[model samples]
Target: MFEGLKVVVGLISFILVYRTVTGNCNKYLAFAICAIWLRFFLAAFHTITYPPLIVGFSINALGSISVACLGLLVIPTPVFTLKKFFPFFLFFVCIAISGFVNMKIPGTINVLVKWCYFLVLASALILSVRVQGQNATFKKLLVAFTMPVALQILSVVLGQAKATEADGSASYIGGYNHEAAFSMIIVSFIFVVGLIERGTLSFRTSLFTLSVFLLVLVNYRTSILTILPIAAVFYFTLAEQRLKPSQKAPVMMIVAMVLLSSFLALSFTMKERFADIGLLLSNLDLMLKAPIYFSDAERDIMSARVYIWSQYIDAFRNADLLNQLLGFGPDSWKGRFNLYAHNTFVSYIYEYGVLGVGSFVFVCISVLLNALTLKDRKLSKILALSFVGFLAMNMATMPLWNIEGLIFFAILNAVLIGHKKSSKSRQVSTDNRELLNAN
Candidate 1:
């Protein structure tokens, strides 16, 4: 009976989220759909059978192919010269060669799953841009992206209540193993929403402040600390408000001095909490302990990541041209029991080899480039900060490789990328246009 209930609930949740993402049918909704699917696939993989691998791979490969086809269907065929195509081609080739040469194909199913994910993501991005001409469309996309998250938050709160009442623990299913990471992802989205919704500073500040407090409760120090400072800097930099000419230089100088002093003080205070804040507020010392404790684990669990990375590096060294392309096919890292490289850099190397890594890096660079191109001051700051957070969070962990991590990264990417195009409207733009666009 319990099992039946679980299945029923899962189905309902899945349907709700899917409709939330695709019903409005914007490009961003497509991105949201893919992000949710990535979470589903990763979660479902652990529970599903092995023989079904072929079926899963076929479905996902078709999805990727479909994305490329769909993009062509909607948008102008992205003109590709040999110069542009050659580099892209070679990059995939290197990834394939490295994986095949190393025989890192045990997790073939997982790789296929990711391919499907990327395919869907690509398709969603294309759709999002195409539907941009409509006003109601983007609002629907944002609502689709956010409303489910709001529901999830409510569900979590209810679960927490039930757990407390029953003296039992509540677990989030569907690829969410790390509660801290999952909470951080949700918080990241809220941060994005706050950016899109322009109101008084007090309102925005209160929202982010509350978010920071909740983050502390969740104890995702890496993401909270990383994202908060970046978000603040990004927000302030992009904000339209500026000091008068007389006060500007002195204010800037004071701020610069405070920042410099703080950095120097932090560097000296490493591994020790700063005296000013209590256990709840000060995290610099705690940040140092994860590595230290993990490094000292009895079974050497943390070192396992190093061992896997070593094997991958050696494989990359031996890889050749054709094998270097297209990747060793997906899910190439299964059976190792080590879910990720514990580092996004290592994860990229193992999954895409050098080529896929290059492409991934290229995409990040593209986002950064587009961030600068943003017309709206607030939107640009938010994109820049999101990117910074995305990159920063990877320092200690690979949220991108895991469901909890990927959801945050994927949603943020979808929203920020959407902002890049939508921010084109200037202050003098049509009121009708203003009413239609969300960002």
Candidate 2:
């Protein structure tokens, strides 16, 4: 069953990349879709199935770098739009400098390459919208996400769910190496379908989100923190505004069905997971109510995320002025403490410095502002609200450290900013024509 599922992902990737290289499909769409599979599914699957190393590097590194190169080749010319893209450019510049100054040469180079890959990915998404228009591009994204959804369902059906080391817990990994990674993928899919294609409620999207939420419950519990508030905003959108009264009823019914079904499925399908679920509830108390300090108990909270964060902060606080400004270096945490800080701000602040973390936050703020300004109100609100969940994720886990997480917000921000830019261009053109007629 595992081999069969791997075959499915392989075939899907081959078909998409072939269509793209052959000019049978949009290069941006095909490449973006295939990159997700390559980055999220294939690399890990390839490793365990065979010798993952060529020379010294793992297949994961090789495959991701190869895909990054392809993205650069297929991407449009880089856009330096201040709010849309420049913040990322500025942010990566900080990363590069910190990497160089701190002498983390090899790791910094690898990190910068990934940063470049992400920039290319964002550019490709924006170009797709500008050329193909929003509706066409978003429809493809909606279709693209179904592969993950299918894999999730199949994992459950075939009983191929992987177990995490903690308490030998069964994680609904859905063909990915880690359930956390799978949860991140589902979060991206939610933004793709639920927020990106707002107001265009369809059977495909409704069913997709239902499975997505259900699978999320059975996977990494951190995503439950991310998805719940977004789900609330989603429900409110369905009921309070966006759709007309006539259109609201069925969507509301769908929302109710989705939530109820997801919980019921969780209860029946994952009885053993209840212990983990109980931990999730308990952790929520630590996460929300417990104040993070230098205490040992606080350090132990949320899988010791707070502890690591406090340590990272303490280290950063004690560092010299140069190190404080620039950071000890990219990925320096592993060298300094033998573990990742596990929180985005904590990790980046220590490794990339205050300046680096500031730019990173700027990129996020830019996404929120861009999403808020989008022409689609439902898309705007849901996406903006989803940012709360995103920020929450960053506080507890290092979601930004992964390609899927970066690409998720990248695609979203691209769509938001690109659509706005395209609309503005058209309006300006129309205005010019009207002026000429008046003259």
Candidate that scores best on lDDT: 2
Model 1 alpha-carbon miss at residue 113, Å: 4.2
Model 1, 1-439: lDDT tens digits are 3234335555665666577655546545555454544344333333442224564544434444444445344432332221222333454455555556656654543443443344335334433543453233333433333333433444445543222112233433223335444565555545544544444243655555455544443434355545665546634443424666677677767766765675565435431322222332343333223232433332233224444444545554455654354444345555543455556765666566556778767766766766667776656666677677777767546665544454454444444433334445454324223323432
Model 2 residue 348 CA deviation (Å) reads 0.7
Candidate 2 TM-score, true structure as reference: 0.80
Q: lDDT per residue, candidate 2, 1-439, as tens digits? A: 6767667765775565465445634667666666765665553474463354776557777776787787766664434343457788889899999999988987797788777667767766666666566666666665455556667767777887777745576777666666666677788876665644445646644754575555464567567667766776665565555668788778878877877786667566555544444555565544333234446655555566655656778788779999899898888877568678778887888988989989988988887887778776766777777787888878767777777677776676666655653454556434223322332
Candidate 2 residue pairs in clash (backbone atoms < 3 Å): none
Output the number of the TM-score-best candidate.
Answer: 2
**What is each predicted model's overall lDDT from 0 to 1?**
0.47, 0.67
Query: How far is 122's C-alpha from truth in model 1 (Å)?
Result: 4.8
| Per-model TM against the reference | 0.57, 0.80
lDDT of 2: 0.67
TM-score of 1: 0.57
